[model samples]
Target chain A: MASNDLLKGMLKPIILKLLLENGKMYGYEITQLVKEISGGEIELTFGALYPILHKLEVEGIVKTESEVINNRNRIYYSITQKGNSKAKEKIAEFEEMVKTLKVFFKPNFGLKYEFIG
Target chain B: MNSLDSKHIRLIEADVENARITINNLSQELVDHICCEVENLMSSGKSFEEAYTIIKEQAGIKVLQQIQENTLYLIDKKYKTMKSTMKITGNVSLALIAIGTALKIFHYPGASIALLLGFVTLCFVFFPAAIYLNYTYKKDQKKPMLNLSILIGGIAFMIGVLFKLMHWPGASLLLFVGWSIILGIFLPILLFFKLKEAETGKERSIYVLGVIGLITFEVSTMFKVFHWPGAGPLMILGGVLLIAVFLPLFASMKFKKGTFTMPQFIFLITTSMYAVVLTFLLAMNVSDVVMDRFVRDEANSTKIANYFKNKKTVAANDSTIKVSTELAERTDNIAKLIFDTKIYLITNVEGVSESVAMKYVSDPDLINNKSNYDIINHLLEGENNAGLINSLKKELNEFKDKAISVSTDPALTKSIQELLNTSDKQMGIGGATWEELNFRNTMIISAMAQLSEIEKNVRLVATIVK
Candidate 1:
């Protein structure tokens, strides 16, 4: 689990990852899925989801379709072909970050103390 | 799960519209999201009202506006910079214009410089940046013509104000056209869009009233600019409609709905203050004191010239008589040439016939556009600088040499040379010839007064020769 503050810069990749897993998703569905995946450790706000989705659509990484369902308009976002490579790249970058950060969690505490002394 | 009736959907729609979401399609997305949230909550045994209350707390106006801001910020790379530039330039130009107007009202120096800089920056930088930012914020709204009209009309109005303050020509044309566009093009289109999006009859009435008031106010402003009759009644009527009728209604409606924001309040106050300032600027009149002074100076020089003209030369010897006669002829030639030049300047500046110019030359206040230097530039400094004024300058200098050669007193010769010298005078700046110094940008009355002064000098030297 990670602090929600850590989710700020990584929201795009998380959203892309979710879009890759599910071929298409609405804004509320993505929020619910992120909360479920992180086991409530990361809570996406009720208002913060659409900007990233809209930006992804603007960058041509995703596309949107608006449909009338149950007497209301619902927008669904789906990843484009361009988003596939971007998703893989972002996942690899996240993996690299996790791998580099793992060193701090390893048993190197006593080694650093000995080297400083 | 509870499904919403059409009535409930309309409630959601009104709530979204109440947010006044400016971004394209944002209200739709937010309304749909809230509907889904409410339906989900209702399935958990909550009533429709309870679910909707919870949803309303989450999707407030501030939150919706924040989402729109974030989306625009993410999509536009230059948004932050453009916004900052618009703010800085708007404030800077406003300050400059305020200071310039204060200085001009007090007749202090540097007012023109400040006004010029303020207008240039406002028209060129601040206006374009503001319009660009506004257009980008609502890029998908399909109202490009609204922005386009505002850009053109706003720029034209600003430049017209500047030119009017500077006493430049074509100000009336620009002011008229700018206001016409705003009245005819901008207001009509804005009213159409507002009417289309209006939810209540009250809102539609307010929008219509506002447009009618603006049209009346703009037309009255044009009438005031041209000083046409009935401008006063029209101005008062328009002001009453806007200040007394439209503004309070609009404010109360917004405040009652809790949609009034801090920026809107600030904008209203500033706009009222701006309109008052504009009214004062329109009422301002150019001072005639400088023109009166030139007229007085010309009259004094004329009196001195007549005294010199009537003075009889007392010649004790025959040689002295010949020298004095020749000197008088030369002085009269120079003086007549100066008078002809004045007549020529008047005819060319006013684009009138020679006879009318000759009649009007003695009273130069009758000539409009007194500061137009195009005729002077053409006659005195033409493309090659060897204009007709060069010949006049040469003849005057020759007169100076002739008087000097005839005089035996060294002091007298020295005074004559100094009095009639027409060589290039380096005033404050550099490299302007004598003709450029005198005639360039000089008012016609002042130019005529200047010729009068020159004629007096030539006469003074002639008396010395006698």
Candidate 2:
């Protein structure tokens, strides 16, 4: 599991990307999907996820729909057209960041290959 | 795949409720998430209770609350900041008002500064923030715009009242605009919507009656601020509606439903409300009684009128009143100056028309008469007259021993100077409102007494030509 501070910065793009791909998802479903996809490496806490999702909703990047399932109301959030473009831009920027950071960890570095990006 | 049973889902719902997740959407989301996590754990061969416990332990209750807090913060940073700022300013304004009232009561200085700061902060910071937050928060709820306007009108009306109390410029305009919005738009819409949502016709009518009372009261207050007609009648009508009509309706409702857990609680509330209404009535009566008695006992009105008439008669007898020198000429202007000062006190401070106030002096023709003891008598009965007296004293100090050495009585001038000094201490600390009435009355009386004493030692210092 990633530390909360590190995960906090990463969660926004991760959520936008998830909604972009999944069409629509509720709070728990998104957390479960992340756990499954990351093979338990990135366990998204409800504490961390909901706020970003809510912020996204407030920004008009995502909109919610309430549906009754198993006699319980589930609020599902879907990415808007704005969110789709935003997600793409964020992913590209993150990749660029990673590529630049990767250059600093060239062979013959102090750290082992296992910890390298 | 494992899914929670109805019983387990119900338990999750109860847990969300226990967490005080009052926001419907957020609470629903929490329950779903908790159920999903419990089910996933249960699929791993744990019992239902064990699975729930394990998931609960993993995601602490504190974490659940943190999510709610973070969501609130994230949705609007300005809302959070404004909310806190509003609270701070609201408290500060209230404190300042309390302290200001106390200062005025004790006849201390800085009362106006405190009051001005309080009102300005309330109007600029607190009201704006409250209006913004109420609008944004209620946007998702019913009648968001109406709620916004209601808050704006209510707050604007309160600000106008403060402005009036401070006797600030544009008080009339502000009050007019505020009352128009509240009475013409907000009140009607509020009544219509509240009645529309009424559970029973009786309840509907009761609330309507209450609303009518409130509207009448507000209208009367607005009228009172502007010094318009029918203010007293309208105010009484509003008071009757609230106390006689609304209170009884409320009691009947409470009794019919048996909603009161403690009988004494309802009784106490009703009694307290009655006390408040009675207090208002008593206060108004007391103010009138005090003002009448004070003015009559002092007889400043009669004295001032007599003095004005005597001056007029004396001036008529001698077309060109002779004085010894230039100093005597300057000294002669003092009487007219005091008369002008009296006129200013009557028109501005008392908020009475110049013509009407002139009637208070028995002689209409003496309105432009030269100053005398009677003129000072009436002039000193005003709160702002203290300021005029102080300025006059200052001007006298500049003239002391320079051009008029023999004409003025030293002992009388010194006493007048002392009185003016004491009056200056009471300056800007009292106003004409019910709350400040006692302080203001005392200040005016003290100044009047001093002016009367000064009037006794009449000195027309005729300068001896070299």
Candidate 3:
């Protein structure tokens, strides 16, 4: 599970990337998805989440829609065109960073043979 | 299962609610993350109470405190920004006031509009903004600055109303009274609070001095309105108080804080300049009125002279023959002199000539003058010429009677009578011509010249005549 600090920094990009892939999600649904993806090891906080959503709304990167579902009202957010493009760029950058980190952890061929025996 | 242990569930609910409200200051996403973590823990083997407490502990008190502190910091930052904006607005308002005052002094067409805009900016926009900013600053501290601003604004409005009521030239008294009222009324009030908050004796003394000075000035102005003998000196003293005492005190106050505002400078400049200009104009207008009265008297004398000359020529010739070349030439010369004198009089008078002329002619000595030649010479001699024309008419009538009695030649007697009658008729026509041609021309030319001078001085069209 990612630490709260790590998650705080990555939250916006992760949310953007998720919205870009899944198209739209409500507040409760987004929290549920993050928990499920992290195998119940990670969580999102409502206090931190709503302000970001509001800020994104103000910045025109995200837009909200309200609908009545199963007798309860919910607000859903979707990535704008600009947000979508930014999401793709950030995901690519994150992937590249992960790829570079893999090289340091990979074992040498000789050391691997000795350890295996 | 003992109804799912309602007490335990209730305790968990209370904790969750407390966390939600307090954590709301943090980002919505963080709260959502904490909520999801607690929900997941509850879904696992842990009870709801255990899950909530565990997640809350893991989140740590330091993170929540940081979030709270960050929110407070942002609020403070926003407040500071608003304060700067208010200060800037106040400066702009004062600038507009200065520009409006300049425009009005120069008599620009849109000066009234400029003044109205300036007042609106000061009273409605900038002052309120300043008060709001001060309110925000003292939200958790002292409360004097906001109250002071409001008091100053009210005093300013009253001064504005007085300005309109008095309609005094140059707006000097208005500005002085306005500034004084603000300083006098608000200084003590602000000082009272300031002393309570800061316990500074220096600030209190400065405020006390300001109030004393302003009250003295205000009382003096009221005395002036009552036409008291000591009013002028009192006004001067008040002006000195403002410049020497209050202004320096305000400056020192600003220096202590290492901050200076443009409004303070503007108020100083505006008040002093208004004093100088108003004093100058008042002195100028009074002298002009006195000088104009003297010039108009001279013009009336010239008019009387011209009147007598026309009468003399008419009484002499009647209708028999055109006034002899000698008399015509003499009359023309007198007429010309009278014409020149009238022009000189009108030029000197500038404005209020007609009233002055009317006042001049009302004297019996001037009104009795009827003969053109006698009146001209009498005016030239600087003596009474009022009855000259009437005397000349009587003299000419007596001469006609003597000619009728002594002449043996009937034809000669008849021709002389005819000449006398023609002269009288021609005199009427000639006098009318002189008035229309010479006097009217002098008036028109002098009026235009005076208008040009006013335009040059005030940058405005003189609406005095036209």
Candidate 4:
């Protein structure tokens, strides 16, 4: 659950990146894609996902349309041009942050030191 | 399997029912999500009971409840934002009221409509919006102070409306009392609680003192309206109370906080000043108008005496020397008394112009004093050793001629003619003395000249007295 907090920060960029590539997705479809990508380890609640989707819609970063699928009305959301640009920038920043952190995790090649009194 | 399907259907119905209760208690969005998950599971080859249980476990009851609360919180946040906008609108309306009030006071032609609109906004719009906001936020329960404000605002509105419609004396005092209660007592108290609740009590004591000042103002106004003594002292005491209690409290608060808002200082200073100014003006204006009426009456009597002196011959009756003498002496004494009283009043009272004082003395129709014709007739008949009937007659003719010269000015002429005509009618022919007949005839001529003046000037006099 605590690890999910770190993942949650990247979820919008990930979803936005996916939508920019795929064009549009429904709520259930987005959840499935996220689960498949994480090998079913990460689960996103519809309650959490819907609000962000609605907020993005309200902020003009996303647009939605409803269509009848299998006798149910499924709402599909697509990233706007603004959302695509934001996703691109966020992904670049994420990659930069990962590269920066990679240096700290590497072993240092310094001479061994004896314990001092 | 058929039995299983029936059992599943029953469970599904029960789940839907339970979800309805949850929706009522929690957020509809969460229930809808749970319902969707249950439906999805049922479609994926699970029995209804199994699907319901599975979905219920997937979203832990506690997490579901928390999510529900969060959703409600979000909705409430949106509602609060909308309400705040409405409140801003209400405040704008209140500001418009103040602007309208200012325009009205400056003598704008449409000031009456503005005043009406201002009162309407205060009563119907701003006050009710405050109440509605308090209710919507559920602040009415958590903050009893808000309720107090609403109550005070409603009462003040009612009293304000009543004050406007009625011409009751001391209405302004009522208005002042109402203002003090709302702005001073209720608002300050509410603000105090708000500050205290926010843990910002540095200026709480100062606000409390402001409230005390307001209460004192209210009490003083009450005293003034009821005509109770010590009203002045009470008002002074109230002013002192504000300075003594509020000023020190304000200083201490400022020392502690190192800052205060501009509005806080403005409200404090303006309220104190308003209290003092209003109380003083009310006391002065109301008392002065009442006192002035008495002085005006006295001056009017003296003027009536002078008019009588100018037209004495026209009023003289020659029924007998003894009767005429007594009447002339009585009229003379009354005239002297009126004139002396007017002089004394003018000397004593401030704002009583000598001309205005003299106007009261010079008013020709003061029924208590003898008319101008009476004085003239007295002199003509040689009453009280006032000799020379011919001289009195000439003087009467001269005054008549002067009156006639202006009589061409329609208003003056019409007024004079009306006076003469009324007097002539009153002086009938039967049992009248020769002097009375001549006086009535002269008055008739004077009236004709005055009517000619009115016709020339194109003015009308509805009533005239000689």
Candidate 5:
């Protein structure tokens, strides 16, 4: 399981990427998909997730539309044009950060891996 | 897999309400989220109550509230910026007003600029910012309409009051709108809601009576500011309701509910404040010393006005217009100067018009030893009247200098010198006993006699000059 502190910084980019692919999603569906895809390893608390979603909405990266579904008012969030462009930029940044983390964490055995290859 | 029915969904919604989600949109979103989570759990073969318990235990009440808190934080960033700006500007403006008022009192520099900056910031920046912040906060709390009305009315009333206090423009319209909205709409709606929200008849009566007291107090102040009638009665009634009825009722309610600990302290503090205000009002209304001054001031003003009116009449009569020669003209001018000086005394001492002043001077009963002797004596003798006397002395000195240069007549010069001497003698009336009120009246009478003599001599000098 990923630590919450570690997951906190990556949650926005991850959600943006999910929206980029899924086209549209409500809060419960997004939470369920994240749990499913991560195989229950990365559980996002609604407490932590809602704020990030709201911040994105405030930044105009996402827009919401409410509909009554099964006698319930469900609000669905979709990526805007601004959100699409921002998602691409954020995904690229996240990939680069991951690469940097990989280099720092990989066991070197006292030699650079590229030189060994 | 089993799914919860509509009644079970309502239970979930009630739980969300219990979580204290005040924002309407946020509450709806939260309800939907919780419903989906619980339904998913129920579909996995747990019963409705079992699924609900599992979901609630996993989320925890604190975390459920945190979601709402985070949303609020995100939205509040925009509001917080304005709120801080309003607070800063309000504080700065208040400081400037305080400094400016102090400087103005002491006759120092930078007073006007400071006052203008303070007033402008308070009226424009701080007040608008406050209105915006108040509007946004209230909007989220399910009373957007009431909030907007209060914000507009409160801001308008405050700005109008500021303008009226500073004697600026556009106070009338602002005041009219502000009073109408606040008194007519906002307060009634607020009281209606307050009464509606109360669970019991006791609570309802308490809210209604409390609001009546507060409204009566506000109306009393409004009446006083506009100089309308019923200020006194309204004030007394408000004070009685607040101190006698509202405070005790409020305290008793709190006691019944076991919510009396911290609230008891608040009640005591509020009661103390009300007591202080009531005492001050009583002192202002009932103190004989204060009322005596007011009555004396009014009477003196009327007498001064009468005195000046009679003088105008006497002067307009054809018999008194005999400035036919240069010497007589000079004498007439001198007499006019003496009368002008006397006018200064009457106006400054009695604060009355010319006709009223003539009546005061002629009415022997008014300046007699037994009646109003203390007042007349104090006006002539006390430090209160010294400012007028000092200014009079300066005017007389300037006249002397100019008359000496213009007139070669020793008689006119001597008359001017004698008038100056009588002014000095009047100044010496300070330490005299209250029993010497008769002596004080005699001094004023003799001064008038000297003035008449000066006028007669000026007429006699007309033949000499011709």
Candidate 6:
């Protein structure tokens, strides 16, 4: 519900960026940080976040460590040494794409429809 | 910040369990995440119940299960391809079958081709892909034998349907196995699962009602396909249960709860479309089966008459041959005219060419045209109409005279006269002419059989004279 599926594709890099900056964060903390940083424009539902986190874990881009808090276990995700570089690469790649996409937003509109090629 | 105690943690865990989060890592993450969310909300003066309700809205069971499905799908490339294949072939077959059925009802050409392509796509591509994807889904969920019976039953049923449409052998075996597995094994397993999963009394009743209705409808489909008795009562019962009892109750409940989702919408359309098309294609009613028997009778008479012709050729003397020559030619003329009429009926009715019509009627069991009496009547009947049947009738009366003159024996001459009679006298209560009595109410296939029978009798009378 956070991004209405538009920000959904960008979540993987966002999570990796958050993990790189925080060094170590639990699931709830990551979500709250995202909401706060995006000025409540983004809400990371645990449903979407955990799958990406688990996939990152499986891919060795991030790793998990568990601690028993209250009656259940809290899993903390942190970027690995390899993930540190991968996170920067993914974030830069996304930033470059977005910067280039801005060109389309200000394009001369409907100028070509008259040609009828 | 207030933290959750053991009791609050158990409550969160119970809700997570209700989502069927079977994966250990995913389950742990969800319970802990909800607990953290609830605690943070509690710190802001919200009660535990209020916070939990807010969390459940975002992470409902449907969302949680979808995450698990997506994660599993992401991990396997082959599964993704098969899943896409399942979707593509299913839709393609649906499109082809819809087009095919429309064409068939309108008596257009290419109906058989479209239907064949549709059935082939369904039986070979979609069913296999669907089974593989379902198996992969069950494996990922760690639910053993979850969709086994339904998958097997569906594949068998679809393949059996394909075979039956093409009039291929071994369809009965496949249909029997398919129906047995669905009715005997899958329905019972489904019933047990529904009972175990449904929580409330209303939910249980609805589930049981749905299963009973589906089973009864499927049973009637089975009975109708196999031409067994009791299909009518069962069909009516199933229709009442589904339409009167089940749909009203079920749809009302869903409307009240506002729980209808996109998948349910697709499922409703696809399932009903499939049932309608299957019942229409698979019924193989009484008239069609009787038509096959007439085709067989025509074939038998032709074979016997050919045997007599071969014998007559070997045994004939010069004088006898000369005497019966006119009779033979007239018989051959009428026979050729009748064969042309049969082909004309098929080509016009099916919108196919002469060559294609030949191919269609060459296989007796596979003939589907020649059933429309109204169009045939329009084509072949009227007072003083110069249709092929009238010309053939005129040719027959002349041939009857030829047969009577050519024969040496008086008894044989009388029998040939009776056999070749096309008189206008009323044979029954009807005030109809000889043409109307024979071809008006009768199917084209039955008429064709009678024409061939006349040809056979002509050949026999000629052979006896020789």
Best by lDDT: 1
Model 2 lDDT per residue over A19-86, tens place = 88889999988988998998998989888888888888888889899998877888999988777777
**TM-score of candidate 3 against the unseen true structure:** 0.32
Query: What order do candidates take by TM-score, descending?
Result: 6, 1, 5, 2, 4, 3
* Alpha carbon deviation, residue B93, candidate 3 (Å): 4.0
Candidate 6 C-alpha lDDT tens digits along B144-193? 35467777787788778777765568987999999999899888887787
Per candidate, native contacts kept equal 0.72, 0.81, 0.02, 0.04, 0.57, 0.70
Residue A96 deviation, candidate 6, in Å?
A: 8.0
lDDT of each: 0.76, 0.64, 0.50, 0.51, 0.65, 0.74
Q: Per-residue lDDT tens digits of candidate 5, residues A10-70?
A: 8988899899999889888888889999999988777777878888888999998899887
lDDT of 5 at B242: 76
lDDT of 2 at B116: 81
**How far does residue B289 in candidate 6 sit from its true spot (Å)?**
13
Ranking by lDDT: 1, 6, 5, 2, 4, 3
The segments of candidate 6 whose C-alpha lies over 4 angstroms from its true place after superposition are A1-10, A41-48, A81-85, A88-117, B1-24, B31-57, B99-114, B138-146, B198-209, B247-365, B369-466
User: In candidate 6, residue A83 scores what lDDT?
Assistant: 79
How does model 2 do on interface RMSD, in angstroms? 1.1
Among these predictions, the greatest TM-score belongs to: 6
lDDT tens digits, residue span B374-460, model 3: 323332224353332333334445444544443345554554454333142234544542122212323222322332322221111
- The CAPRI quality class of candidate 2 comes to medium
Collision pairs in model 6: none
In angstroms, give how far residue B125 of model 6 lies from its true place: 2.9
lDDT of 5: 0.65
**Poorly placed runs, candidate 4 (over 4 Å):** A1-117, B1-110, B134-141, B145-149, B152-154, B157-162, B165-209, B225-229, B254-466
Docking class of 3: incorrect
Worst 10 residues of 4 chain A by lDDT: A108-117
Tell me how far the alpha carbon of residue B237 in candidate 2 is from the true structure, in angstroms, after superposition. 3.7
